[model samples]
Target: METKNINIPAHGSNVLRADIPAEYKWHVQDIYADEAAWQAACAEFKALLPQLEALKGSITSAQGLYNALHLQDKMSQMLDKLYAYPRLQQDADNTDQHLQAIAGEAEALAAAFSSANSFIEPEMLGLGKEKVAAMLAELPELAEYKFYVENLLRITDHILSADKEAIFAQSRLATGTAASAFRSLVSADMEFPPITDGEGKPAIVSEGNYMLNMTSPDRELRKNSFRGLMGTYHKYRNTLATTLTGSARTAYFYASVHNYKDTLESCLAEDNIPTSLYDGLIQTVHDNFAPLHEYIQLKKDVLGYDEFHPYDLYMPLSKAADSFACTFPEACAKVEEALAPLGEDYIATLHKGLTEGWIDIYENKGKRSGAYSWGVYGVHPFVLLNYQQRYSSISTLAHEMGHALHSYYSSMNQTYVNSEYTIFCAEVASTTNENLLLEYTLQRANDEQKIYLLNQFLEAVRTTVYRQVQFAEFEKFIHGEITAGRSLQAEKLENYWLESNRQYYGPALTVDQELASEWSRIPHFYTPFYVYKYATGYSAATAFSSAILSGAPDAVEKYLGFLKAGGSDYSLNILKNAGVDLNTPQPVTVTLQKFA
Candidate 1:
């Protein structure tokens, strides 16, 4: 109970959106000139709904299918614009009621539109694959939809009868109850006990600020925050285990109902990713635990700690040094230099977005907490960030900008149907930019900054690559248990979590009991089998980063091809064209060596 004064920043009194400078805020107007314009567009779109219904029965003919597909594409493009504007507006100031209503209207209309067009996929599949291909061959205008149509046909086995599909869709509401309970328990109902911060004032630990405290230089603060945070979760262990078990059961049910062999197969089949890709990543990371152990040992040595624990993992090795912070303009300049290898056109587009209010740069009251790059078709991408001027924040700026530029390229080059990239490729673009920033900064860093940068890079690998795989393994274990007809009771979950952590953390470190309770708090468990993509994506980025840095022939062009390639190809194949093969262990091996 140390009670020394802590100089925590003040909460409350959030700055109004109107009070923020125009340049520092996101340009929501780019989506629509005003609310009145948005209303008119919504009306026009609503009136055009009958046109889609008109083509419902006539899609049997090639020309008719082409017309329907073309019309759907046009409607989607406008619908995206209509939805993106208010959604972004609501995010900017979540406390505003007007924006909330606008967002609701936009979402409801989009959902209705989706329901209205749900017949297209089933009808198109009913026409059979050969007929669809022949129609595609006959209609040049629908050629852009070849891959889309092919994918729908490829998954024809999984698409149930209309009545069965309707039942499954309705059951989704019930299937998701476990996830909803988990979310409610963690976010709304969970309470973290107050912990002492640096200088010893009482501070409350929360999800919003937990990472900040975890990364604090104050040892007691970090230790107490970890304890305080997990203590709350520990109390809910049994309840959470049940909820997680239910979620896993739900995944199994869906897999069984859909005729997939297992939960992992079902999830991968969505992106047309093979099970080998997932298994290869787990096997590779398991084989290469030495780099991770060595990095952990380095942290212990550098931090001068007698024993390393989970709480000690996030503190910077160069804790006594001043934190690196930059102004928004300065961050942009650093990112520009880092992204220099991506070609002038890429840089030019990024520069325009940076200056032209495409980014919401600062954190005021009620602004979004984390960061993301999002936009609909026909408009430039918008990034939401809480820029606090840290050196890592510069990397984050670069990461989101990478996503933004990827969207820019995809939207500019590909049709609306193919403009949105998959999450597998999306993470690659962002992490590639992060790697480039690390390399660029290292080139000019002094000894201290170099050590700091290396430490940061190692941290990135630890969290993104190693930690995510550990999570993936845990996910696999629980889902495997369910598929094998075993129950995921609290004790079973704790044991499995501890075993997974020990395997990754190695014999050099202690696997604390508190850490086993971590599975109770992870949200990804509800989504089952989604964490491995982070590991795979980061490995792919490392490979691409190395290629571009080594000046390999056509490397830049291949990498740019990756950015412009949206949903046109399967995720793994898209990376294959860019020269990184996830099916092999080389990317993971190369990334591990880089960590060394």
Candidate 2:
């Protein structure tokens, strides 16, 4: 536990609203070098809009289609570059009007693409499945476009008419505007309680520091932080519930209007994911409930408690005690050292991420809650963290930087249209690096660090794989109710969530009444049954990490291929190409057995 005083509150907006934060945030001068340069690029980006719209209806035959695809590719590349500048800049400073202007530029870009995307899908659907198949089989250049088109057509049944599509497209921004605003406000504005330490109340507890507080061996501090945190949440629960409810209803409404069966199918269609993959993850977790129970039992044994509490779950077992004694700075240094096994290039990239301002280390006022890795095309991935120098904080660096590296590779190799991979596979890259970092630590670390590493690894799996699966199951359970013509009331939701928690944790632990209100606590449920990937991806990543560590030939090559593949292929098939099959229940089963 190498302790270092990081000026977190000064770290500013780095943690808050970073999804829209491009990592390579240039200054106003850096972007334009002066007003003239920014203006010129803005004008150039604007010009592409009219040109792209004209090409949409003009392309029907092979040559025309080829030209259109080329144009689309070029346009996308330019937009990626153009958008990266302002958004990245804005993310760094919320008060910058120029950055806000750049952010506002997205509306126009999105609106322009609406016409083009609506045109391409319907036109391809009109070409019929036969034409699409023949084109894919014949032309290598057209292979990616064909896959894109085929998937578009596959969801054609869910698509509305041209007029409706345009309306749908335009409304996309407005539809989620309030919810998007709420997400920003909630994460950015919600106040956290200040924490009291032995001497005095030193830390101004924020979401970032809350985790560290929960792990404090000091029981009063831990309970104070946890209770203070939940108390803050309690004050805003109604506002949050309404905001989230509106978001969920909007999601539900859009799927229904689009002729889709449900929000789950609609989300899967958006990324070309199969529903079977989603269901398979849920079903796999269902079968592995025993392992989850066993983990809880082990956790109880490790904590020396016959009855488990939520806070005790994160506490170190007997051996891990020594590891936490190291200061926070020591942990950061070790993170760099432990991650050295990822090849020279990968290590340098991680180092670059650390040294470069790619990471905005520490918490600050109005910063977003939690951790995330984000960057646009043609930029190094930047991660925003409200970091406390704990062992888990180092683990977080490993996890988030994994995502940054993955995006760095993918965006470098693929065009923007295909560059963005789906969330299903997103979890793997991050978790795989985490797994690697942990293994490296256990091998090289001192006894304290080893126990710390072990505890950290277990917690990572528990959170990413088991807990996420549990959340996924609960999410789906509620959606199932919606499917069965049931309404989701707050009381009913609380009951359902607590019931699910009871089942997951087993009858051994006391289920606190406050935990029943946990349904309102999770922001991911508003994402429409989206938590399962954390489970599935971690499972797949665990296997991938094990394989790579075994000195398997081409392991790195295949792993790199998986990162670079992006949305060029569906996530599952891409993972198969990389190695790890989620279709069989084995991946999750194997991950569970590791706990044994």
Candidate 3:
């Protein structure tokens, strides 16, 4: 039977941004009172640029170094406000050319600020280790920046000469074009063929609804959407191949230039992650493939499908069961209930933020898809959502709130330099919220809801854990191939992706030729070695959340400490303090046991 196409029009497709209710929108005005105020602030920030620039070549004394560091921090704080305001405005309605222009100007201003300050690092390194240490001793204020000082001295070899660093700073845009080009292709240029729904209605295939289509109970429609989407990617294989290959090479380029052994090392070094941690994640997933394969087979049995295809992966076994939908207020209330273990203060803060304009809750025309918790140092965290009243949406709400609260706590507790969390730890908080919501719901659910919850958990593990590991492995493979002087041709990438899928999905699923083009669609590939963190973070979160739900003493406290710690410590160290070690496979093993 043909599957009925679900028509959940992406929120931003038809409505005016202004028409969205004020209660449902984010109040960015708190960041800057108005455009005039933002403009005035921008002027002041521009005036301070030369002041920061003047400190270059004069770091011989402690006071001079202290002044430069403080001025730089102040400028950065102002620039965050300047950059975030328009950027959020543009994201609210990307079709607005005025807002887009403003966003562009903000970006350019940031780039210019970065370029102007590029001399600081190189010149500081040039001052020689003895001089820098002596200055630190001479100026006791520098003691607060002890971590910053040691980190700089540690990477002295990677710090380029002033001219080289300046020239390299100017090349950021050109180097980033591959990813930008891929985004434009998929989001703006590529189009999928319309597929008829099971209701005998025509449904447009879009990035927004393609996954929703995949979850259709009707087999034919799922096949159609799958084919339609992947087929489009197949058509643009060459262009995408060039983009992917270029991006992979770009990662290698940056790593080689900086004297790292490979791109993974280069990327992970920012958070002090060792290459063994990355490798251990992949190895652990391989060891735990039994649970994943067993789950896939269970899916086939539950759905009564004699043959399972890649297209059949998303739908639950019982299609006719009652599905979940909640209003925005309902979802918020549920979130508050699910996170009750975290104490009243945490929930109250989240509630205040939600009601007091910290969330942009609905979709409007030209609004960005997906959700995120975004904020600057001096402001409260803001969440962006294209919230549809589905169960996943509730989980998304929880997830983003997880991020928002993490930012809130970190900002309240840490210095500006340390307030921002690394991406490695960032996903942990979000996924932990998801685990809590799942567990809380399961606790009160009937048999039907229990089944649905289990299915949802499995699907989450599959996508975030298995699928992400596949991507990560694919990244490692391509990077290895590229670094070894193998050309990243389209066919080569497709084969690598195909093998990764087969390994991850196992013998129960059919691996088709069209699936080969899947690599072209992942935006993360452009970022290089980033997808692995999703798997690692999700695994770590599952462990942390389970501990908290078990009511272990200090579990919630340790998790909260993890959030507040932010970049104050390296990511693994933060996780270690919170009670999971990614360097070992225990978290991965414990996470998989949940599936078994």
Candidate 4:
């Protein structure tokens, strides 16, 4: 996707100046040229049922099974287009009726495909992986799909009863609806308190306005907004809890019905991510508590606060009056130039992304808040950012673009069946780009940019590594308690959160009384222990970034290979493919040493 020809105007101080750039409006035509064509494809997918059924019995032998799997891969790959069109379309201008309908059509298509998929897993398990692999080895078509087949086979031990699995699959209408509704609620309905300026003057606050306020150079106003927003959100904690609990219950229910021991086991079982990776993050954080505490001390000292509080964390430690503020186009150029070490091919894709219409790069009316990179498979990634004119906001451009470029490269290279990389490897790509951008900017810096880049790196280390590890540890504890059949009461959750704050911060900083409610606000806890990678990814990315910058022999080649790998390898193997060993303690220790 490219935004080259789109007419987007960056107008106003706090308002969206540009309409949705044309090319940035995903190439839905890549899936089907028009609504009528989408309907035609829908009919085609449904018409294949007789064929999908015929392959069921025929897949009993190796050749028959290999042929069937190849065909199934085609059907599934095409269905992605049929499903992805709506979600991406709706996400662009979430309120558009046509886009919403498009999303609905895609989801309905997915449901139909799931009905077909409900049989594939069980039938494959029924055939037994060993027999299927032996037969697949002899067939050329199936050989390329071994990783996918092996991925499926590895989870056969946890396969639910065929009847139970089918019921769960069909129940997507109700079960998925619950989560979807809450997502809409949070995205489209939730509101916050009015923001105040540095002198405690009142200002209007809305979903899209809070980001500009949070990055305000006025420490006091940022604090006021942070406190006020947290206070307002705390009021809806119970409601948000319902949203999260409903999602968790669905996870728990499926895990239980699917014959898995618990939610964590079931989640990691399919993804092939080990529970130890999660545990490794927590243990590493616990062992390195002192650096985090020292980093907190560094903030308190630099900010000249009598005692540091959590609200003070996001504020910058140093700022210069004569700073260069980047407009959207300039930021894009900086990012593209900074990441040039990734090779010409990578830079060219980013160039197309900027020029062609892959980015919706401004704040606008009724736009969904926050930044993200998303699109259906086969199309280039689109980025949504409310690009305010601030230095840190420029880093955000680099960050979201990292995700977009990662998606772009992976989709271009891999088939839809295996194109999308897991969240486990996701943060590294984005964070690695941030690292590169910082290195390049800092290397070319005057005193001000150097200070800004150093402080930015500090913030990155603190937020991604320390803060997320803290969340990861908290999530693990919460899940362990829940899995052990204990209730996750709000009071218990707060106490553990505050106690955690004490341990991680040491005896230095005073914990805010109200901030004890932080646990109630973190939605990651509800995702069943998912935030650890934010820390581990940063640590790993730091090592990788250092290598590429150090100009070590073959360093750039290895790092680029990692980026191009897509979902061709598992998370650990992907890192090893790029030349880092997660199993050894090296990456963790290296990150800690950098902090020291």
- TM-score for every candidate vs. truth? 0.88, 0.87, 0.93, 0.90
Each prediction's RMSD to truth: 5.0, 4.2, 4.0, 3.2
Q: Residue 198 deviation, candidate 1, in Å?
A: 4.1
> 1-596, model 4: which lDDT tens digit per residue?
23255344643223432354553343556556887887787888888856876665566776777666766777887787777666655654555667677677767666666666566667767877678778678777676677778887777777765556667777776676645665566455666666767776887555555656655667677677667766766676666555555666777778887678878778776657777776776787688888878878877887788987766766666574227475567777888988898779889988887776666666555466667777456656767776766776777878877888778777777766567787777888788888999889888888866876787787787778778888877766766666676655666766887898889887667788667666655545556656777777787788788888888889888877776677877878888878787766568767876776
For model 1, residues 1-596, the per-residue Cα lDDT tens digits are 12145222333214566777676778888888999999999999998788886777687988888887888788888898998998787667666778767876876677657655655776777888888888999978888888888888889988766446545654665577797677556644676787887788987676556677777788889988888888888899999988988999999998988899999999989898888878888888888898898878877887888888888888887752354665677788888988999899988988898888889876555554567899567878999877754777788899999889889899888888988888777789999999999999999888888888888889999989899999998888888999999888888888888888777877656678887788888787888888888888899999899899999999999999998888789888888988988778888888888887
lDDT score for candidate 3 against the true structure? 0.82
Model 2 Cα displacement at 295 (Å)? Answer: 3.6
- Give me the overall lDDT of model 4: 0.71
Winning candidate number (TM-score):
3
Model 3 residue 1 CA deviation in Å = 42
Those runs of model 2 whose alpha carbons end farther than 4 Å from true positions after fitting are 1-40, 81-105, 133-144, 195-203, 301-307, 318-333, 481-487
1-596: candidate 3 lDDT, tens digit per residue = 11145333435445788777676788989899999998899889889888877887877688888887778878888899898999888778766778867876777778777777888888888889999988898888887666677677877887788777777776775687787677657654576787886776877666666666677787788888888889999999999988888888888887888889888889888777888888888888898898888888888888888898898898886542336675677788888899999888899988887678889887776676678889678889889988876788889999999999999999999888777898888889899999999999999887888888888998998899888888888888888988997768888888888888888888898888889998888877887778888888899998888799889989989988998897887788888988888778787777777777
On a 0 to 100 scale, what is the lDDT of residue 127 in model 1? 84
Model 3: colliding residue pairs = 3-198, 3-218, 4-198, 12-364, 12-365
